[model samples]
Target: MERVEPMPLGGDVARRADAHAAAPLLNCLIREVAQRCPGQGGRRVYRLPGGGRLLRVREGRRPADPEVYTAGAWQRVGHTDLVKLVAEELRRHTGLSNDELPAEMIDSRDAVAALLAARDRVAPPADPYLRSEQSLVTGHPYHPAPKARGGGPVASWLAYAPEAHARFPLVLLAVREDALVEEGDTAALDALGQAPPGYRLLPAHPWQLDLVGGDLAGAFADGRLLRLGTTAFDVWPTAAVRTVHAPAADPAPGADLFLKFSLDVRITNDVRRLWRHDLLKLRRTDTAAAGAIEAQDGPAAWLSDRGYRTAAFAFEELAVLVRDGLGGHVLPGATPLLAAALAEGFDGNPLDGPADPAVWWEAYLRQVVPPVLNAFARHGVVLEAHLQNSLVAVDTGGIPVQALFRDAEGVKLLPDVTRAAGWERLVYCLVVNHLTEVAAALVERHPDHDPWPAARREFARHDVPEIPRLLTSPTLPGKTNLLLRWTGADGADARYLPLPNPLSGP
Candidate 1:
């Protein structure tokens, strides 16, 4: 992963980690629980209603330098103190206590610290794409604990972590053909390695293997699963720790593939697993998404989740998804960078050096907005176009030329959800989650540039009936990640609160 500068694990490392950890928590706190209490001089001040405490911060897309009012003055709190403050406020606000989320918040900070330390010893990949994929240190900008690795010991997950520039070979297993349960096209798996006559090839994440080893011991012993050693090539983990990408295979050409696996660890709100229900519905969702993107007029593409394979004995625990890689979709001369990495600053970020902010951003809006709107309006497919799920391909001149959207598991079919619900989700994922972050990053980089006008025009061009209301709506739905976690709601069960709509602003 591209890093900010190298720092010794000691000295300012803890402070830096504190800052990294604090941004998202602060964002969630201010967005969900804290009420705006007028501007304090040039800084933003908020009143935490539950605790009756006044807090102030240097606010932007990513708020920072937090200070709480106390003793007739303001006192800055470290991450530990911030976690305690958040917990106390949530407890009072919700009338319930959550020890786990706070602990995860701390774990997330410590994980950032460990990632910073590990990154110092390693060299970043020469490939800019890999660097972009691994660039997230503060992940999920609005999430309370985006980097928490199930609170597991540093030694366990560090090596597999993408933030540490991790690359490793997949553990190859041969499942008895009769014991394997698979769907759709998974032929790509056979080429990864060879299996015996009665067995099918199944690649596993080493970290996941370690997590579920005991449960699979019986299968191994009884010959339902056979060890076939590791793949010859190393795969790089993406922002999503469980999904891995295999670059061009050594002698074989066109061997690029992305494999998604079941991770027992909880990175964000939910345990990152390839759940059976989603897996069963994958092909249908992916097919619909692919068809929609194909029908769109622009260069936007859908990275289809082609298929999955697993042992029936441990369906959810052992499932691995096959997704189309960048080789086919990306433009010939352009580089595909993770959209999240662009929002989260990376070393060679394309947004950093755009010649004209207007042209670049207009191109970006052109490539990204239409396909998403068309898919929902024309095909009843709602893509999870959040930053993490989107890839923006930029040409050599650092101009965005194409947008590739992925992860069918997160796609919601139209009739599956009511039209209102689907539009709300499309708005949240496309506008609130995706465009807002990109626009914020652009505005932060070029202070004089305002991106919303172009965004408004882009939405105006789309024929969806909801576009008109969306353009005039005074408020946009913002997912309450903090409240959702504290209330122990399912990760998929999204609850939203109103956020000021810049689209409607003068």
Candidate 2:
């Protein structure tokens, strides 16, 4: 749900869109297929193994300004040409023609262009939390097509896209008590509206309802279901597009509550659905994470996926997950911002301020690292603690006082995954995928600073057996999302590559 993406664009917006799109694409090419070619001056050169052609790009967090050496000199390639070059290179590299990935690359770029065009039109909510949710445009920095919305027309998904800063009410549905199948405490749903006798309230994402509405026509006609109209208050969609933050009802003073619904369409990878299997196991995993965090010493908390409700007939399609929101979990006087939002900045980012780097970085390490390691070592629970799943609540001085983690669907128990496999996932999600991005953002702002040494010390202080090896390892495993997508591997089945260890060296 979170990737380093081009922000709401300005200047020559077309060129901005091209660069933004090309950065992740170029990164994918270099990481998955291209071999490095040394001595290319200010730009780095890589050999496309498929064509044996030399290509160059100015490298940064997001590689940019790409060129291909042709006709005795380097010639720049725009996003269009870059896509063609990547296709040809991949053909030679993998010995397979991937018509799908290439189209997705183009689709991602086009989506960015569309988002750029629409960003200014929709007014972002006054709430900073909502702003962070919609801040990502360059999604999944390593993903080739982070913004490809199932290749549908821009108009199809634009109204629901978080990047567009769109907000709307959920469509209310009343399923007959006989038809409603639910587990856990879904009291939050009943609070949304009153249900007629013999029926229960089920709030659905309007976009998802639009996607699966036709299938439910029979139920509506047969009177098994009834429409209670839309909710009076609008809910802001978060980075995980299907999950929304619904503001508390007026006259009730409390924190916002989160509602996640099944989305049939694919976003980055998997179809966004609350699958039946995951729902069955949700309570155990949520209990593990919740207990682990509660047992810890600090203010760290786990936003439990308290329970789920779904129609018995269309289980996965109609499933809705209720999760705890920021109200009670976040430390008082501290504003909790998405870790992804901190990495991919937004208006009023605490990181974009005057906080001392060492102190801020140390506090961040303390808040984020301990709970993850503790969860894995103490409770044998592996949290997908990547940036999108993390929240850092910063005090008035913009110092992190607590960390809140969510999404039980992504949680893997010790025995569910081999301890070895779970450890790998925890390292990837917590260190490579989450901390590295945050550290890089800090360094980018500080210029001459190195935040990784403190990171090394943080891990070294942990008593877990994995810490020493992690600190000394020559490389850390980084997810190869582009290659994973190209190979059509399940997104949950992560494939990794050895990236140079920043924690071990300068």
Candidate 3:
């Protein structure tokens, strides 16, 4: 396989890490910011509007062979060069300077190198669920630095990295009941382990503990918090990284439970903490989502965020969310897989099988489309139905039978956000981010196939007012992750650029 341009880095692993990290960052640069420059030789070249330097790459879905036109010849760019080049270009483009983004880019590349090396030593989990979780090496295809791990040390995050296929037990703690803060139903937690009198059991993500342990020294010293040891069973980290699957939750089958923790690390566009504001609204939002799903017809399910619990002193750092697991909701005999993993490809992805292309695409639409529309149009609930937040279940025949959506924190209540804002967010998540990736992957494996026509038909059936405009609009809102980071905007604040709508084009 093609790796990064020759570098004095470690080995195949480091070069591979460079290639993986650089591609997504370059994708954002080329698509959202860079303008097409007339070609030279046989290479595809683009002029960076900000830096005014010609950048060239082997053009495809994921661009490679990044070179900058300098002096006389094209200088092959390494990961560090690419980061500097991106930072310079963004500075000129935005007329702003960001000291943090460049470091994040370097940190992201370094994290990938670490993950690559760790995966080489760790065996991927045999379970399809865990395998799918661990398989996202490329990560967010559009984000400039999807794999960045808060710029922390490798040893600090490696043991909990889903990409490394590493699984470990939760570091159980006893928060003095007087110090315990909670919301919603956190009853399921009590079954996992026990706590001493006047102490409530609070399970902590091992990595999060390591990251913020020093920050909580006083609580431990005052006996407000006591380490109650670790869970006897290991909960495998999912693709989301912070959330984990305890396959054995005793009476509550593994499928019926998930524990999401706050990691003091910035993942994707945000510091992935179960923020206090979001946690406070979890019940209202999740209830809206669950009620919407229950009212609809089909196998679609909302993996409700049941509740959260944490110590008052370390609310954000120690908070853990209980999410409904995927077991009871899944159809009988159907196996569920991560939607992102399917698009990105995993060992046993049904999309990779010999299923009929047309039937497969149609089945996929039937399972994924209607519920999302129904939830939005009928109930005014906006779900972050992106690939990672969605799971598709397929039968023994490899045909999708149901769609399950999770991460209530990403959901927006109807009146909570203006209808316009919510619809735009829903459109960005469902169509641009979710469906587009899956459609492209399907077309990639079957070149003659066009997934958009079916997609167009499915979307058209929805009576939502935006459907007509969406069907004919030449451009869809594309999120600007690279620029957003360079400009140092809030991660929750989405800024969009116009992208050619595939449903409108051939």
Candidate 4:
């Protein structure tokens, strides 16, 4: 096991937390509401459209050190003051009042503080992939409240938080055979724990169980659900928060497996529940995604959502989706790292010390871009290939060799939506959300390196009809996460605003 990186503690946690929370909030405010203004000094400045206030920050990928012009003086705003400013600005901009979002922003900052404190006490996993999966302290770089944990007491969620490097056993349960609702291949669940006669084994996330336990009392009281002991081995939580990865043979006789659970907590946009509607269509979506990736002519792979199981009585509340682990998919001798963690940065990030960044980035685009384009162009499958949903496996020399994508719930099939709509979504997920962040992070490290020309070449390599326009389009769709949350829009209902396309020029 490599030595874990030391994290900030004591007095630094609060100050770091303030910075961590402010960056994303500032990003949202600047992107959604603030109009770019002429900078006075080296710092970047923007004028708030609604409040008519001047805001300035030390600009980079994640903007920081926010200050507002007040009474002829630029006064620095801390996390709390920033939240108030955002809420006021948003309320005036949208002509809508939202008290929930501001509270969530505050909660998200508190969560970061708690995560930093907890992380200081634990050792990170030895596996680079697991470390990468658990390393998102400042999540969703553009969301208003990326780390909010349902605005609950910290103690309630801390033990299960991925950012705090938490790993715990699943609470095993048994649903009566007649009451068991399942689809696809869930044979793996039986290996986790034993079920009594006439009942099938089901694994439940402890946090989800706690949130929905009241509604499940009837099943427990009756013969519908029975309590089985917890799993013998602890599973590591991924950045998704609700999903956990059980190490190979941790409980014996099986490879590593990812288990996605019904988390009632609202992590970023919506309550992270395995809704019945999504679950019902899981097999169809998973099948399409798996088939699409399998057909692609590269090392790209899809971590198939094999199956799910839950008590029929509490379907969405107790559901757990079993996903393919990295054992078979990732090339041997290559370590798979979460793409988001690469962008966010971790202790052993290969992106940190690339000798030839252009070569490394070209290799990255080769592995990442084609599979997504092929999936959409050939198989009519739209993968949510954003940072979190993507993983890049690198060889010993830290060159990306393979790309893997996951999350069946986010996959959209063509003809179900118009070709134009699918193309738009593909552009947003593949280009705006995924590549742009990675490119910016690369540029941040290697100031002289330009990633877009290689990206343009990579896009030009593909025969997809949208490639020409994608390279020539002046603006790309940037999801309006701030406006969506403020207006109480559905999390799945994505609204986009135009963002300048670097690929469009040159």
Candidate order (TM-score): 4, 1, 2, 3
**lDDT per model vs. reference:** 0.91, 0.84, 0.86, 0.90
TM-score against native, each model: 0.97, 0.95, 0.95, 0.97
Per-residue lDDT of model 3, residues 154-263, tens digit only: 77777788888877788989999999999999988887788899999899988888889999899999999999888777778899999998774433323348999998
Q: Is candidate 1 or candidate 2 better by lDDT?
A: 1
In candidate 2, position 394 carries an lDDT of 89
Regions of candidate 3 where Cα sits further than 4 Å from its true position: 1-10, 38-43, 249-256
Q: Which ten residues in a row have the lowest lDDT in candidate 2?
A: 1-10
Q: Write the per-residue lDDT of candidate 4 for residues 413-441, one digit (tens) a residue.
A: 98988899998998999899899999999
Report model 3's TM-score to 2 decimal places. Answer: 0.95
Clashing residue pairs, backbone N/CA/C < 3 A, model 2: 3-140, 5-138
Cα deviation at 42, candidate 1, in Å, is: 2.8
Off by over 4 Å in 1: 1-8, 249-254
Clashes of each: 0, 2, 1, 0
Judge candidate 4 against the unseen true structure and give its global Cα lDDT, from 0 to 1. 0.90
